[model samples]
Target: MPPETTGRAIFISYRRDDAEGEAGRLFDDLVRAFDEKSVFMDVAGIQPGSDFRKAIDQNVASCGVLLAIVGPHWASITDAQGNHRLENDNDFVRLEIASALTRNVPVIPVLVHEAKMPSADVLPENLKDFSYRNSVELTHARWNSDVALLVEALRSYVHVAKEHETEPIHATVPVQLPPPQPPQPDESASAKSRTPLFAGIAVAVLLAVGAGVFAATHHSQQPAQTAPSPVPAPAPVTPPAPESAALTPFIGRWQNTAQLTPKDSLLRLVVSNGGSQMLVHAYGKCEAGPCDWGTQPAIVDGSKAVTSAYQLRNNPQEVQLERSATLTLEPSADGLGVTITNSYQDAGTHPPGKALTYTFARATGS
Candidate 1:
């Protein structure tokens, strides 16, 4: 294979149902950071009537790295027939991964949406080796940092391939010359006698010719010199100022104006920028008085703003104690609203919890 075609690109392998959204987001970010032609996502690159397996194999072999996006249900998700998808030998995800591993390419398993690395026992024989590879997490809250690390890793391999492509070429040539002949002995005495006289005349003639040529050449080539200009001193260097807080669309006060709770219930959220961190203060009513769900820290990853779990101060005595709440900030379609999910449950629930979602409108003038 030519140096330009050998391990100079990236291939993305993902299950549609499991991580389609995450994979698309990653592809966009990668294209922005690197050459678009060097990044390949199957859905966008594959054509109609193409040999599917052959195309995947060729891409995997030519790519310097492969990113397998694994979502929460990636390993355990079932097909229409209620069978595990990975168990099938002909699964596209399995084939892509197996081909990459067989070719000794770098296969990075990108875990997203709380996905965990699968163990060897859960994988098919052809894909069992994938479990041992080191994985990176691309959470909604850490998308930028995670993708930056991935880009840096792939850059090294790309640099090596480019170096090979630019190597210098060398060539050689052969030349031949005739040998010299010896003088005759018969004319040696007379030749020697005339040598000194001829040499004196030859020397005088050569010197006169050389002097004339040198004087003419020097006169024609020399240019008139002018006075030298003064050199300017370099300006002093100034240190760069530190970056200020990033301005995000979510940086403002928002209030829950939705009507589904008690008449006295009121929810107010305040988001402020703090360099890389986003500070959030949420206040509301649980029954009649203030809901003491305290201040929280959030970070923006892509379009989503996520925060760590905070303990609710007003848990009912009959219910479980030590209950924690996680808040997720989702943007509304019109970009003028935000959906705040105040999830108190530890596990999955459709809609998460009763009266958990609060649609907040951006407070005017704040």
Candidate 2:
């Protein structure tokens, strides 16, 4: 309301090869807590053929905080040759982070997949400070709790920025009226000036007569003053309202978004708990029959699903954690079906597996 300063946006920096999946998941979570426009990631917003260096500088400059996503190989990732990628001067990750550090923005190191902070000796001269900053970790064992803490720390900056955006900008411009002409012989300006002067004298005489008449009448002593009342306790803070159902299009059931048979694949989406929580049940093809992967929770954020569910293998041979999977949906043009982005993290690997996508029509009754 007061020119919208003292607030800032969030800038996320991560390597596509290092922690792209985690970065995307973090973006969705932040979007739910703050405005979508305020939580920005280059993958979803950047257009082609533009000067990316300028874009990185602009975004970093406007941000109040920057999240540096560090994975196990974040420091050691290599390009086509054998050399480490971070050594390159023109690397986008290095450029954006350098900008934030130079501007004194709060740079938060986000560790994922059990990554440790890179020592100052391992980092470039300008980026060495990144190792000393306090960091937060997002672990598979407790993703929700860890992120909640991070969000709590970020509230001070985000709430102000959001309030600034929600304020209505005044659009009425003042009109400049011409000055009145000099009061010559019988100009209207002189008549207008005389009107208020005469009105003032009449108002003063009326007030004097009213006060004299009141003084003549009886006057009594004022009543005794009463003691002040005690103050009431402040009310408890209520949580903000949840996202509207109209904005969340994926609020119903649908058979395998991949459209595979029970023998090959079987999955269903049951959006319960007011559409904010989801139960995903699925089965994969195996020897003899389908492997029933039990149901698990996937937190829904608008059209996207920030899944914490693990796909378990329930086959004749054994039962164990197969892969951690995330299911995100985008409805089709005909409004009859949705496209799904099924991303997963493998059991043995720490890095997330490539996300697989599928499109299917909404399933009918049972």
Candidate 3:
């Protein structure tokens, strides 16, 4: 087995009883695009003696992206007892998808042989978001063209296995990421400098209050100065800039109850540009790491909600990168959480997917 990836890795998830053949073909294609060590499938990469569930969850979380190869029988297949395969907690495909969704792994449903995207009613609660994620279709006739679209989008996240490849190149050029840069010492000093300013403002407020109290006490003890000279009020201290309306209830780390699409489908809301501008930092599941959907520029409306746009390569090709999420804060017993309503518009033949809503709890440390 190859050593695991420290960077983002591509994870291919498919049911053996459903699209094993197609999954194998897809794996071969991906291996040529990324390093062989960067692509993973099945128990081939699991070490011996590891707990099955923990191992699978660890592998799923470690991956930056997951390809859910869905074939016609993918959903309807059953166990020997005739129960639906998806209903079983131990079902590998179900477990894989559930983990990916819960952990915010970008799961691009790869429809094989023109398999239709599964409907929400057909899916279990945790897997319902699978119905709405943008999907790519792979048929024997257009396999190369279709896969090239998939490869082009994946380039944004995973490392390219080589500089040359045997696959047909009918689409875009390879994505080249900049090399890592050394951390500058000045930035840390700049970060340090920021602390004193805030501390100074707080100190100023305290001093103002103390002076006001002392003046009143001293005035009471002294007789009124000859003839009243009208004294102007002390200058009003400008209150430190109020926190952005966009930061109140919405700022924090949050994850969806259903656990759909990566990087907010709301991860974290942070202040940027020295708090002059508020930025929402979210992640979509990706290889080598979670693909940063970027710090979404957020605007707050009168409703006390922040609005932002998010894009990802989860569903690439003609239909790649067009999913959207509507987030709102909901008051809970513990505190405020979030609800993410996801919608997708496929630029290809596929129509707009249904809007799926998910409740998100605040992340423990956020």
Candidate 4:
């Protein structure tokens, strides 16, 4: 309904059956921090008989960030697929979350009241650790602070969006990228000059070889000159060997598995079925060296694996080195692609606290 570039439009997803008032309040608060057009809500924007689901889908797809307002009954709702959908396949929440992810959009989950956060057992393996702790309280003052903090964070992301949309920052940031050097005439000239030197060396070698041959032939006749022994053959060279994988997972703070937590760091992984859940303990270490040996708890879900030691802290040392992956019996490139972030120290940081994220390929080996 409104012009898009409204600065990273915010999409709020909640169960209309549970806390409609809270969802509405959140939209109002977010609007105050952003523009009216930057916020999307069905009551405010969606028209009747205009394909509400499709409209929600499109808005969710277009939004730069999705805010999941998790209330007591949020996850209890059943979608058309009869699945408890929240940002996963067939789940509107999943659909919206996936779209944002695919478009590089961020999804922020805001828990209100007594709602239970989704754990590995209830959610797709990819989203298990994304659940926030008892991050939000229902109290008015805390709610206001949380909302304000979220707004501030959204604003920061919007600033990032604005900066990225404008002229590329890397282009103006005084990078060390060297300008392309023009072809030097001296290189070609040098090659040409070396040709004569090579010819001269060859001639000298030939003369020396001929002299030796003649001396050897005449030595028998003159008993004076002796031919020098032929030069020994040069030894063969060996190339450098590949690195070993002995010290992985412990190289530094690496995610023991796909759950987005640094290696060797302490994390609590809750795997649940129904209301019963089991806690899987793990540690994180910084991924470094070929072995990434510093990574720990080598055994995860009966799987023995290690994480890439690319991100020592926040530096992007390796592109193929996924910042994190989940510990599972069996792993795949896509099955475990969780990444860990270290922005949980700030009190007002939206989602307040943080947890290690792990990705899963299949359900589990066993």
Which candidate has the highest TM-score of all?
Answer: 3
Q: Give the TM-score of candidate 1.
A: 0.44
As a whole number from 0 to 100, the lDDT of residue 313 in candidate 4 is 23
Best by lDDT: 1
Candidate 2 clashes between residue pairs 3 or more apart in a chain or in different chains: none
lDDT of 2: 0.62
Q: Which scores higher on lDDT, 1 or 4?
A: 1
Badly placed stretches (over 4 Å) of model 4 are 1-8, 42-44, 52-54, 78-91, 124-138, 159-366
lDDT of each: 0.67, 0.62, 0.66, 0.48
Please state the error at residue 269 of candidate 3 in Å.
Answer: 22
TM-score of each: 0.44, 0.43, 0.47, 0.39
Cα displacement (angstroms), candidate 4, residue 59, comes to 2.0
Any idea what lDDT model 3 has?
0.66
Better of 1 and 3 by lDDT: 1
lDDT of 3 by residue, 4-29 (tens): 63333788888888899998988888
Worst 10 residues of 3 by lDDT: 265-274
Q: Higher-TM-score candidate among 1 and 2?
A: 1
RMSD, every candidate, angstroms: 20.4, 21.3, 22.5, 21.1
Judged by whole-model lDDT over C-alpha atoms, candidate 1 comes out at 0.67
Ranking by TM-score: 3, 1, 2, 4
Separately for all candidates shown, the number of backbone clashes (residues 3 or more apart, or on different chains) is 0, 0, 13, 45
Error of 3 at 274 (Å): 40
